[model samples]
Target: MPAEKINNSNQAVAHSFAFVACVTCAVSTAHAQSSVNLYGEIDAGLAYFSNIGGHASYQATSGLVDGSFWGLQGTEDLGNGNKAIFRLESGFSTTTGESLDDHPHYVGLANDSFGTLTLGHQYDLIHDYFAPFTLTGGAGGTAFAHPFDNDNANNTYLASNSVKYVSPTLSGFSAAALYAFSNDAGQFANNRLYNFAANYQNGPFTAGAAYLHANGRGNTAGGAFEPVLLPGANRDVFNASVAKQNTYATGASYVIGDLTLAAAWSRSTFSGVTDADSGAVEPSAGFSNYEVSGVYQLMPSLVLAAMYTYTKGSSAHWHQGGVQADYVFSKRADVYLEAVYQSASSGAPAIINSADPSSSRNQLLIGTGLRAHF
Candidate 1:
């Protein structure tokens, strides 16, 4: 009877171990089947500027290097090599509760092994591939952008109703293309944009080229209109018109040890017009601009950066330069100080008065800020 009792005890212990192993396997499988992630960054700072045209004021701003945004992304395995994926991103002003550009909800999707395509409002290819090489990336938002941001450094050309496609990388090379529909119903050609870019990176060097085209209408006739007496019958003229613009840029960057160098060149043009009164034809006006910049690492967590930019308009030219230093307290947090100055050429329109070519304006800006990410 004692031998029988010993055998029964051994059997019970084996059964208990088997049940625990089964439960562990079930929990592991459940974890593998589900996943969700949350991530974002917040940037804010105080800024002071001298010679802001006719006004002198100090203010706080958000999203200098990278915009403040939060997003949720997830994926689920369906079967075989297929999976389902989605992302929802929202941009907002960190200093205020307002949404970024007043658009709060942005979302999109991806297919396994094919590519990613997103909808709603988004950045152009130039902003995605080239903006990172500028001083704004390292100098804590102190880099000088081209006059009127004609070089696209300030990201003034976000596309609405945009669709973007990014190809899978092959041997350190990848390509992307994007198109934005105007969605103006019958006015399909109005406010439309398209972009394409290709890039290659191997080791410590990277290079890219991109092109952008945009067409839109502007209101230039809303101000008080005065007509001078003419020999012909008095006819009221308005200055509303359709504008076409094109941008092309190429950039390269190389990193050796702790130092990195970068440079870029770009050109832009604008033309086309429509009379506001009778929708008649009108003359077109256009301009071109260029920029270059560099940066260096003083320590593992400290960096110094500078930039120079020149913009040549139809009636004026502009020169701008800036520098800044940044210190990283951690992988996700940093603080920085930046300063930028601008000087215009005689042939360019005055920075203060667009109508006076002889007038010149100088601007100085200083700021300090902090940024964090998760």
Candidate 2:
């Protein structure tokens, strides 16, 4: 072949190779597109309690209203409107820098039309669906909780070894389901849990409900609901192992101009209760809670809220009332002040959600806190 012809052939081969490399790089960039984000929120404050184990107390507090937590969340675009997502969240005490519980630690897939599914440690249906209508970590946090948070209206627990599914919102409606494994051989039902929930929101109106069932809750370490429910000594819930627990809750809210009104109800039943250490079977117990709350947007960046709850139990009962004021300095920071009063039935100790039991049947708490998001 002539020299010119040979050079032309070599240049043709090089152009072909370059074209293939460019196409490969373009495809790789499209398919491998992904993103990850680190996110967190912190709440710290000081509180005064009128009665805690018989004495007035003042102390530093963390998560006085909203729990302090940090987490990472990410998503990878997978073609055809599908994506891969994951989140890992952990709670901690701001006062002492101690680690608390964890949640939403799972990986899953999401689609624009379908929805989301995740596996691992996560919240139950009640917290996802119904708790929003109450003051659960919203306008009023710890101050608005029911007696001992018996109904989990304040999100006191998380399930491990779990699988969760959430449906996409359609016409202002959504649904969810979750199941947690016991993870113990030969004991499939021990400490296992299943939950279902549905919610709807349309403009100024919103409604939701949820149901949760657990067998032998707090009975096994390798199961859901391992840690005891509350932090108080009053109803023995902190010291009791529930053989079976069932909770049902529903709520709704309506927004009118700058004021919002809300109402909610929940029932919790405990059967075959046993002492955690002594293993002594105790009588069955039940709790019914009814709550009404309202929030007023005093200004664009400031809000005032109030709530009242009445809890009736098989053995004891409580009445709780609270008020809160919050001012947002910016999109990432806020300050709040709250006051709460709780009174228990005769002969029953008053137990605030995040505070120790009062020696008598009445308790009061006043607090102020600041929260920042990043």
Candidate 3:
């Protein structure tokens, strides 16, 4: 996903990756060009769930298992191994035809030897480097999203008003860093963000590691992040604002013939947490996640993938599992059937990402849909 590779997302995800895996699996290159191209994906489907606001429900879903977006990408050949690049992407919901968030739009300059530098909305290290190794980052996608995407393995948020740098690969290694400004007067530390990550790939194996820190995460109007951690089901009780947040992760994957295996671990903490309802402050909230997954290309057009995740919280825990079968119609189209399940510690309602919490401690989801890109 170098600036030189206009078609590459720098390992961006499938369905956000199955592009989940490939999207985050490789930072391989594709030749840059001097023309603009229109690209995006549409994923729509029907889903059945055991609990949503305490009721079994069925509904139409969009981007339920993958990202849905459209955008323009262009690069100009600047000669002497130099290039100018730009991208503008927006996410949307196929169900309601409503707007979602914008992707990491950016403008940058690149050189074959010097790497790339860009400024604008962007992704941080958790998503760029470590996510690829998690089920949520690859083939499992939405169905596999870790509880509330606490580690960002599901890319639940973005770094806004930022500057980023990506280095050229050296001996199978490449690295990236990002810094987001608070953009608020007299509040430089409020919602400011910074992160770094590195990845390596050789033969059938790949590994990555990353770290991120945020000051005054959701405590102001600066917009580095929106303070979306789910310490509990009660949003008012678990305020989106935090004084500080730190997270780190590592993961690896290996391929063998038509099969792939992967594992990942992540830890996150939110300090000076507060209850918006009570104006009560707590010491901190923390989370740890462990996951393993596998994918098999049973045929050229049909593939299967599965994953399991265990998450430990300061006072609760959850276990999740999911599987998907995708059948390709062409290079630009596919259909899939998937299912996901979760069981939470006693007294804690089971909740899947993007869905309401279960009335009890268990929940399940089943879905089928079509996804296409151009």
How would you encode candidate 2's per-residue C-alpha lDDT over 292-328 as one tens digit per residue? 9999999999999999999999988999999999999
lDDT for model 1 comes to 0.63
Note the residue pairs that clash in candidate 2: none
Q: Which stretches of model 2 miss by more than 4 angstroms?
A: 1-32, 227-237
* Best-fitting candidate, scored by lDDT: 2
Please give me the total number of clashing residue pairs in predicted model 1. Answer: 4
Task: Report the candidate with higher lDDT, 2 versus 3.
Answer: 2
Mark the 10 consecutive residues where model 2 has the least summed lDDT: 229-238
Better of 2 and 3 by TM-score: 2
Rate residue 12 of model 1 by lDDT: 97
> For model 1, which pairs clash?
241-274, 316-348, 316-349, 317-348
RMSD of every candidate to native, in Å, equals: 9.1, 3.7, 13.2
Model 1 stretches astray by more than 4 angstroms: 1-34, 79-83, 102-113, 137-143, 217-241, 273-287, 347-360
The better-scoring model by lDDT among 1 and 3 is: 3
Model 3, 124-234: lDDT tens digits are: 879889988987788767768888778887877878888999999999999999999999888888889999999999999999999999988876665688765452233
**Rank ordering of all candidates by lDDT, starting from the highest:** 2, 3, 1
Candidate 3 yields a Cα-based lDDT of: 0.84
TM-score of each: 0.75, 0.90, 0.88
